[model samples]
Target: MTNASDAAGDEKTKTANEKAMAGSETDTTSPASPTVRTEHEDDLDDAFKYLHDHSNAESTSIDLAALRRKIDWRIVPIMFVCYVLQFVDKVVINYAAVMGINKDLALTKNNFTNVGSAFFIAYLIAEVPTGESTSSHGANKVLTHILQDISSRNFHLESGWALTCLSGESVAQRPQEQPTITLFSPHYYTKSEQAPRFAIWYSGLGFGQIIGGLISFAFQHVTNKHFKSWQAMFVFVGIATSLVGMATFFILPDSPMKAKWLSEPEKAALLKYVSINQTGIQNKNFKMRQALEVLADPQLWLLTICTICISVSSGVITTYSATLIQSFGFTPKRTALLNMPSGLVSIAAALIVGFGVRKSESRWAWLVLCCIPGMIGGGLMSFMPASNRAGLLAGIYLVNAITGTLTVIYQWTMANVSGHTKRSVAAALIAGSFSIGNIIGPQTFQARDAPRYYPANIAVMSTQAGGAVVAIVLFGYYVWANNQKDKRQAVEEGLSSSAGNEKILWENLTDKENPNFRYVY
Candidate 1:
């Protein structure tokens, strides 16, 4: 009886091995045309039948423990540090502008505004290409190269700025006439010089974000100190990012299936894990037509619109929160300290919402929740202007909290998108919209509204409310669409309802394909 059972088990194992080998061959030999719609459905059908009907529980290939072990540690922490530093470096310029950098440079009001707007302009132009490259290559490699290039690009610019500062300081002390060097002119200081300063800073902002989640993934054990700026933060970030890039060459896997860090048992498990959910590219070809199809999705348009509104609304405060607070009666140092809390609020909000979305498997809840504080903050600051100082401070903190939701927007897109090209393009477009909004937001803070900027506040309040409404509506659409999909799949597959909660749709994979993929309201 024992020998008979062993022989039967051996036969079953042999058959399973043969099937897996055949599947491998099929995947490798499949047509390169995404439009071909090759054997994916057939393979899925077989996988579904086996998992659904068979009692062969032991035939599964899933090992969560190994997956946890294979992930690289350097990616996530460095990414987070880089992002936080990027924001700090970007915003600190706003502080410096108000401090002495503007007066020292004698930057005309119009020129200063251009300087600010220039950051986003370069960001808008570079983002799409960078995002596309990041998508085609991996985020890690792209991030590393970008950091190196941008850092090298900025090294001389910063040195020039520093020397210019020294010259300015010397003139300030000696009370001499300004030199005929024409620092602002294209001949003396070209766009090649000044433009990079803007580009690098904004690019750094996007760069931080592009890889921020990976930071969360790798640095689950990190603390707040990891993000703070006192410890040569920018320099550290440049070095760390470079190092991570070097290390990732060995440690970072192209995909779960391609991870060399994993054993054969672990690789199989990882593939199974990824396969359980559909992401439009089931080893599908990456094509320009599919890219265009993604672009044609209306959901992408809605996202771009929402991003613009949100950027306009939230960005105004990011540029001037400290200045606004100083107008409220804080000293320069105190203003800096006050802005620190707002920064912390943003970081906390990002982490909390990131984890919450991943755990609850609900992007809408976090999106809606984060938007509320900002909306309320904007409203309170605008309408309740005569309120207590503490209340005003609370409002400002909440406004800062809005900073992290950009991550929610991107992650939500990533979760919904499976096609590599589509995700890459969509992320860049969304980022471009954000840059446009940022450029517009700060410009609205005219000199006439120095202290309070009541008109700007009102505009921000309106936009924040608009953003909140958009989030709620999008959430409802996603829920309804998810249900419709589950129903369709059930009826066609003729399979008993197995909780369709894990269903991945084509529209979801396309980044804009699904009318069902509501924006992260």
Candidate 2:
């Protein structure tokens, strides 16, 4: 009887405290509690529920000034240098190819071309796992792993294995060490070996492409000719990249949450900024099950398809940019000069998309805004006669502008998706589509259609339009679904619209089980 009296008195005290606390405007919900079990446990459940839900909420405004002071510019520059060198080393091949790589290697029409396409096949296979590697381990870990893989593959080539294509062409290849050359034939290697090596080459490409932006930001002062210098451009870049990556091994943060360089206040600010920004998936470990679940989603698959179409359009340049420019009667040097503008456009696009676009909210608009010009430009170049050199160059720049649009698409994928597994899988899916387009892009460049491949230009224009339409429709659907889910959740909790939204904000109120999560289109 004494114990029961004590419990009643304690309950009354708790009620009084709750009422007093409720008068103030701070969330006190439990974060760790599950919304299951018996209704009879109302008081206990409410307390636990409040604790679990309120932990993520706070009233602190972002201190932009203090946060800027905390940034380690030294570390950022080193990271930037590492990324730049990685890109320049990979793409120097493009400039080198135009200069005379095929002639030096004695590469035939089929042989020289096959090596380029082979990279994509390898990229598609390796990139999925590599994306996961970034999530599971960290950016530094994945970058290190790639470096190791590339070094190993280069060693394999150096040790005497001739690279070949399925067409039975012994493309320009490094010679093997064996006295008898019979083993050097296409019969010597397995398809499995070729696939992985090809994948690695393309994986290198993916790194270069993404890091290109980081490079541009780091050294925007350097002229194109300076960057294109024979010794400094390729050889210096390779050496510098290796050195900077070593430096970054100590400085670069693995994950935002794991950044020890930040003080407690800085860390809290960072988390708050990311949370309100709607930057998804800050956790370290990769979740394979969640990735599989996302794969099973039709919305994700459709996005992949859209990615493939857009990639194919962008990929035309990967295969035929120099050749097409040469066909226009520009000298080799002039063609190289023209290519620089595209990179500039890409850099501009990254800045605008990364900064100007506040949320993943209007991805479709950004995509179309960039894409429509690309198609119009490509169409003008392809359909218009080559006699108009200035027109053709203008069209080429337009096509190049698509690079920025493609980057935005990639960013959108990262923003919309949550959980490491889904992100890895989704990244791979998008990359694989990119590879397919690369393979297909070059094929569109028929020798007969050369000097002016009207059909290839038409194809690019049409597909880009298709991609835009799909993005628009999908984005609308995503917004509509979010609204319906919000309503349902509000009704379930017996809350008014504003109150429900506040509750949801405090509790992570979106249904993880319900299939209504909007895929950023």
Overall lDDT per candidate, in order of appearance = 0.47, 0.48
- Where model 2 places Cα greater than 4 Å from the true spot, the runs are 1-62, 68-83, 147-234, 277-288, 359-361, 494-521
Report backbone clashes per prediction: 4, 16
RMSD of every candidate to native, in Å, equals 14.3, 14.4
**Candidate 1 per-residue C-alpha lDDT over 280-307 given as tens digits, one digit per residue, 9 for 90 to 100:** 3222235576578656765567667767
Which lDDT tens digits does candidate 2 get at residues 286-344?
44567667657655666776777777666676656666776788666666665666555
- TM-score of the candidate numbered 2? 0.69
- TM-score per model over all chains: 0.66, 0.69
Candidate 1: give the clashing pairs: 76-214, 76-215, 471-521, 507-514
List the lowest-lDDT window of 10 residues for candidate 1: 175-184
Error of 1 at 277 (Å): 3.0
